[model samples]
Target: MMNVLSAQDKQRWRQDGYLVLPGFFEQAATEEMLGRARQLLDEFDVEGHPLTTFKTEADGEHVGDDYFIGSNDKIRYFLEPSSLSKPAPGAPSKLLVPPAQSINKIGHALAQLDPVFRKYTLENEKVANVAKDLGYHQSPRVLQSMIICKQPRIGGVVPSHNDSTFLYTDPPSAVGCWIALEECTPQNGCLSFLPGSHKTARVSSRFVKDPSGRGTTFESVAGVEPNEEKWDELDGWVEAACPAGTLVLIHGNVMHRSPPNPSDKSRLIYTFHMIEGAEGYTYDEKNWLQPTKDMPFPALF
Candidate 1:
């Protein structure tokens, strides 16, 4: 494979824990993705809503009733009729929606066509390579999409935390590519990351409930001591203000979070994970672990 990442870019990713790749997609691709997303929302009768988060039917309730209350019609479109009436197989009370296989299929195709997605999926091989360098060989994993449509005066904040907490994998060989489908600014709750925080030796296992109240935070697992200076230095965290089509590649272990989208305009973004393949790696099927054995690796463009 051709080396898409420069030496400096790799170094920066290793040291800073993330990289900002500007113009990762052309205008046409960006517009297309946004269009497809809108069409999907329309197909599901999801419009004029506050916020939307998509999860498998098995995990739907964990996503909360707030996402489904006013948008029942939309929710029904994505979920099977049986799912709405009966609970998912494993999680009855949780209201988990079975995996939206169709949505995943569409998203996978879009990822191949979108420039920003292609760049991260194809050009940015550094993440997997780095894991190999570190002695892990796992393939890429596509987790889930987090789509948000912030209604006027209805947005909320997402506290700062590392993604590593939610994902459990040996050797920690996963990276996520977050692409902005709309203009993201500080006012719109753009993502913020703690530069180079992935290299930290500690791994916390705190259980911080997500909006759905089922997820846990990793900050408690690592048990990292707070350093005022380090916090202050990272406090100068940069907000990724990019036009649609900008791709932000971040380490799985990096500390990151986003505020609420205060703007009326929706902030659309998709996140995908990739890993290097090797033996002796174990995955937790019971827990939502990234790069699981059953989940297919993200397609390399």
Candidate 2:
């Protein structure tokens, strides 16, 4: 494995809670991943798809269902909320565009199901090398891989949140690797991060299955108020504007979000989260996404 993280890179990760490495992957590789994502989107059979719209607002109804919960080990498609027509009273909602163009993301287990995605993710030694450089002292397991399709003009906003809230561990050791498959600009809903927020912010809540086991809800962790920490504040936030093939490493506690895409161009990106999997750390069984015995989380090493 190659030592891609230099002294400066480590410094940036420590100070800013994130690192944007330009040209981390070649153009050809990114284009290939982008092409594969588009092909998967185009080939998706939406005829029977529940057309579940994806949203990340803590106050809004989260995207969850059998289709979503079962996606832990499968590649599933999710629709963009803005691309759907409002349903009339007692009527079902309809998609305003083609299935291929109406998607918000295809996610949760792309690396495990898709050969192409697997090649860039788990099969890539660079990913493991980077995790090692970041000092994942105990054990690191990759999970929750997705291709975020910031579709043309209807891509929805993702409210500021931390990865640990979703993929929680005992000590909250989740790191996200966000790779730009297409050019990410402000017009197309590029990510914005609150610099150093990881060091300051606390993972006080988690998205877990409800007691009924029918749906999910955000519960305060250890009696901490989930709303006490404000993520809406934009002061000192930096826009992560990068070209294709760029890789952005995000700390688990960093406050980050993206605006809606109102531009004609789409901002496509592949992202995955890694969590500490050592014996001491507990991966809550009540968590919305659970690993099956047959397809457990793969070690980063």
Candidate 3:
């Protein structure tokens, strides 16, 4: 299988701070993923458990908005695990994997069955190569998952922000892989990004209201103030729309957000994050970032 990114692609990533690998997964893989998701939902329902939960108020005041089924509680949880399964000792403590075989199957399948999917992760060649190119020797770390299931009337917008601010890391080196499980279009609240924002220095953190108004606004970490008119400056900024199985890779420092799903159908997406190594970083019990590393990449990958 092809394992390396083309020089042109690398250059584009360097220049734009993001890259879109359209149709990275085949129809077969996409269908399989959907099947797995359906099975998980059924299992959760059979057990009288919720298959989807809210990751943020942006998901709206419904059970399905920003729905995430299976094991990933850090993203959202659908069911509680049975006694047959249990969480790992000192596992990230995010409740990402519920203690159930059916739910665990989803996580396991995601980690093993899909190479193209796996390649976007921190351990993947592209990430490692990027880290090395940037003078880091360690591989990036998987931060969290952002799963979305947009509702029709209630679908809410995710405001612009940088992911780096939420994560606590030094020399901030992280990226996000957003995989569309269903067709996404402007009508369905597709994601939009500001190109080259990641290459800029980190900006001050701020708080903004979540579109759904479920509660307090999500704390935004890495976006410039509106007065900066950052979006107007990026000629390459594009609204991302793609069919199922498309993957959008973005820098952690990049500014991005999505609008409400105004369409009749739901829009499903899964986003994951990776960072280069675990050293020189500190986190509180809440897993929020605290200061640690003071220097940039010191070693080559």
Better of 1 and 3 by TM-score: 1
Assess candidate 2 and give its lDDT.
0.87
Candidates ranked by TM-score: 2, 1, 3
lDDT for each candidate structure: 0.51, 0.87, 0.52
Model 3's alpha-carbon lDDT is 0.52
**Which residue pairs clash in candidate 2?**
none
**How does each model score on TM-score?**
0.62, 0.96, 0.61
Clashing pairs in 3: 50-78, 51-78, 71-96, 73-96, 140-275, 140-276, 141-275, 168-289
CA lDDT, candidate 2, residue 245: 97
As for model 1, its CA RMSD to the true structure in angstroms is: 9.2
Error of 1 at 232 (Å): 8.9
Query: Which window of ten consecutive residues has the lowest lDDT sum in model 3?
Result: 100-109
Candidate 3 segments exceeding 4 Å error? 44-137, 201-203, 206-236, 281-301
Winner by lDDT = 2
Q: After superposition, how far is residue 214 of candidate 2 from its true place, in Å?
A: 3.0
